[model samples]
Target: MRPTRRRATVQHTPAQQMLGAAEAMLRHALASGIVVPEAVVETVELACTHRRAGGEGELEPPTPALLRRLARAHAELVRLVAPATPRTILLLSHGRRSRLAMLGPVRLVRQMLVAVLVLLAAFVALSTTDYVNGTGGDILNSTGLSLLVNELFFLAAGGLGAAFSALFTAYRYIAEGTYDPKFESSYWLRFILGLMAGLLLPALVPLGADAEAEGISRPLLALLGGFSASVLYRILERLVGAVESLVRADSRELRAARRAADLAQASDRARLERLELVGHLRRLEQQARAGGTPDQLAEDLGRMVGTLLPVAPQDADDASDEHPQPLISPPAR
Candidate 1:
C-alpha cells in the first residue's frame, strides 16, 4: 500500500474570522479614499496569512508587532470615522445660551428712541408760541420782532426735528447690530442738516400778523427747541427695553441648537473607537495560531498595543542566498 499524504486542515476561531472580515472591508474602503489606520491593515494581513497556512486549531496570541499595528490602526479608524451623538448635541447647545442672550439688548434700544423723539417734537412746537421782544413789544403782536422771533422758533424747531430723526435712526441702526465706527462721520452731517432745518422752518411757516406784533424773542424759542430734543431722546431710551428682551430669548434658542450639533459629532467618534479596538483584538488571536510561539505572540501583541506601531516597508530588501564554496578547490581544478 502507498503511504497517504496528510492534508492539514485549518479552522479559524469566530473572533479571528470576524477580525479578518473587518480588516478586509477597512482596506477596501481606504483604497477608495476612505482613511483607515495602518495598524488595522497590518493585523488583517497577518490574520489572512495565518489562515492560509493551515494552523487554525489553537487560538494563537498575536505577536508584539501585530498587536501594536492593530492598536494604531484602530485608533486611526476611530478618529477618521466616528461622529458625535444626540445627547452630546444637547449639552453643547446649552453651553452657548449666552450668545442668544445678547438679542435682548439690541431690541430694547430701538423702542425707546421712537417714544422720546415724538414727545420732544411736541414740546418744542408748543414752546415756539411763548416769546417776547426786548423792546417791550409783544412779538406775537404783529411787530417785526415778533415775526422774526416766530420764524427763529420755527427754524429751531425744524433743526430739533432733524436732530431727533438722525439720532433715532442712528440708535435703531445700532440696535440692529449695524453700529460701526465709520458711521460716526454721519453724526456731524446730521447735526449740520438739523441746524439748517432749524433755520429754514421759520422761513417756511408764516407767523400770524398778530403774533409778529406780540414781539416773540429768538432766545426763548431756541431754549424751548433744545428742551424738546432732550425729552425726545430720553423717551426713546425707555421704549426699547421690551424689544431687547425678545431678542435675548431668540438668541438663547440659536445657541442651544449649535451646541447640540457639536456634541453629536463627538459621541460618534467615541463609538467608532470602541468598535475598532474589538476588531484589532480578534486579529491578534488569529496571527498567533499561524506559526508564532507564545512568547513571540505575546511580544507581537504587546507591540501592537503599544503607542508606536511600525509600518511594513513597501520596498524592503530581499535576503540573498549564499552557497558555501567547496572546502577543497582540487575537485574544480
Candidate 2:
C-alpha cells in the first residue's frame, strides 16, 4: 500500500478565528428567522478568506481591510439583534373557572405547530386530485367510475373547511386576547359574518363557464379549495404573529401594535442623508464636466463634508454569493 500522507493542518489567525465564530453566530440568528442580511455573512466570510490568503502562521494583527469588514458586520449585528424590552402576549384560555392566562414560550410553540399543519393541509389540497386524472380520463378508469371519486373530493374539501373552522374558533380566544364572555359572543357574531364572506368570495370568482370539465366542473372544485384556504388564512394571521414573536423572543408587534418610531425616523434620516449625498455627487460631476480646476473642486467638496458622508451605505447588507468589498473610505482621487 502507498504511504498515506497526512495533510498539513492550516492554523487560522486571530482574525480568521474571530470571523469563524461570528459567522457561526450569524448563522444561528438566520436559522431562527432573525433576518441577518447577506452582507453581514459576506463580511464575515471575506474577513476569514482574505486573511487566510496571507498564508499559514502569519500572526499579524487584523489588517485595516479586516477591521473595516468587522466594523460592517458589527453594525449589521447591532441593527438586527439589539436588545429591546420583551413584549408579553395575553393568552386567555378556558377551564371550569375562567381567568386570565399568559402566552409563555411553550404555548407559542403549539401555535406555530398548528400553523405548520395548516400549511401542510393547504399544500395537499393544492397538489392532490381526486376528480380528474391526466388526459381527461376517469380517476377509476378500470371500472369506468368517477362519480364516487368526485364525491370523495367534495367530502375532502368539506373536511378541510370544517377542520379550519374548528381551529379558527379555538384560536379566536387567543386572537381576541381576552376571555370576556360578552366580548366573545360579540366577536363570534362578527366572525360568522366574515366566514360567510370567505365562503361566498370563492363562488364569486369568474371561472369562465365553457372551460370547466363536464363532471362537477374544475371551477366549482377550485372554489371549494379557495374557501378552505381563506378560512385557514383567517386563523393564520394570529398564528404567524405568534410564531414571529416566538422566533424573535419579542412581541413588539403584539404589545405596541406599531413599531418604534425611532426605527422609522432612522429610516427617514437615512433616506434624506442618501438624497443629499447623491446631490453632492451630481454637483461634483457637473464641476468635473465643466473642466473646473482641482483647487475649486476640492474647495466645493470641503464645504460639504457632513453632506457627502457615504453612498450605497448598506452595500454589505446582503452579503451573498457576490462578495461586495466593504467601503473603507471615499473614492480615490
Candidate 3:
C-alpha cells in the first residue's frame, strides 16, 4: 500500500513572504562566514506595509539606501560560499597531485642538474680503482686478470658512490632541523635521473685527470664529485619548493575564479528579486491609492507575491499554499 503524506501550510502576506526570502538568504550568508551590513537586515525587518504595525515604526518605501545595502549583502553572500583554499603544507609535499601531474621550468632545470650529479657520482665510483692502481697502489698488478678484477672494483665503487650520494643528501636534509616532511619536495625521479647521468662519469674522469686539471688529485676529484652532488641536491630542493609555490598560486587563482563567478551570479539573482519586489510594492501602492480594502489589497498582493519572491527551499516541507506556486508552475502563459 502507498501512503500519501499531507503537507502543512502557514499563512503569510506578500510582503512577509518576500521578507522571509531575504532573511533566509541572509542566514545562508551568515552560515557561510559572510558579514553583511545591519542596515540591510533592518530594512527587511522594519518594512511593515504588509504587517499590522500596531505600534511598530512605519517602514518607508524602498529608498536608494535600502537597495544599496541589499545589493552589497547579496554580493558578499555568494563570494563567501566558494570552496576552501589549499594550505602551504599541502603544496610542498613531493606527493602533491599537482607536482606529480606535470613539471615546470624550475622543476625541469632542477631535474637536469640532478641527472648530472648522479652521473658524476657513478663516474667517481667506477674510476676509483684505476686511480689507486695508477698511483703506485699497483693493486691490479698481481691479479693477472687485471681488467676483470678492476671491473668488479669499478662496479663496487659505482654502487657505493650512488648509495652514499643519496644517503648524504638525506642526512643533510635531516640535519637542517626541519622535522616536517610535509614541506619536503624530493622525489624518486631525481634519483633515477641521477642514475641516468652516471653514464657520463667515465668521460668526465679524463677531464679531471687532464693537464688542465693539474692540481686536481684523486681525493680532490672525489671531493668535487661528492660536493657537486650535494650542491645539486640543494638546488633541486629549492627548485621544487618554487614549484610548490607555483602550484599554490595556481590553486589560489582557481578558488578566486570560482568565487568571482558565484559573486556575479548571486548579485544578479538578488538584483532580479529586488526588481520584482519593487514592482509588487508599486502595484500595492496603486491599489491603496485607489481606496482598495485591506482584504482586497492582500488578495491582489498574494496572487503576485508567489511570482515576485518564492519561498526558500528549506521552507518547503513546513508550508504549502492553495494558490499555484509561481516558480514551480510551467510558463505556459
Candidate 2's TM-score: 0.21
Instruction: Compose the digit string of candidate 3's lDDT tens values, residues 128-234.
Output: 55433534212333345554444344333333344455555544543332223442344343344343333223224443236334764433433343334444355
> Which residues of candidate 2, in runs, are more than 4 Å off?
1-145, 179-333
Full ranking by TM-score: 1, 3, 2
- What TM-scores do the predictions have? 0.23, 0.21, 0.21
TM value for model 3: 0.21
Task: List model 1 lDDT by residue over 1-333, tens digit each.
Answer: 999999978676545645553554454356548766565676767766755565646666566665566555544554443342222222223323645434223322233345346546754664545553332222334466566555555454555555566666756654333444355556546555555545433333345557546764443334333334444344445657667766666767788988998899889987887787777777777876676688877886786677345565545433222444566777655
Better of 1 and 3 by TM-score: 1
Best by TM-score: 1
lDDT of 2 by residue, 11-90 (tens): 86655555554664565457548887777887877776765676766645677876777877865664554341011121
User: Would you give me the overall lDDT of model 3?
Assistant: 0.49
Count of backbone collisions within predicted model 2: 6
Give stretches of model 1 more than 4 Å off.
Answer: 1-144, 205-333
Task: Count clashes in each candidate, considering only residues at least 3 apart in sequence or on different chains.
Answer: 66, 6, 2
lDDT score, candidate 1, position 82: 33
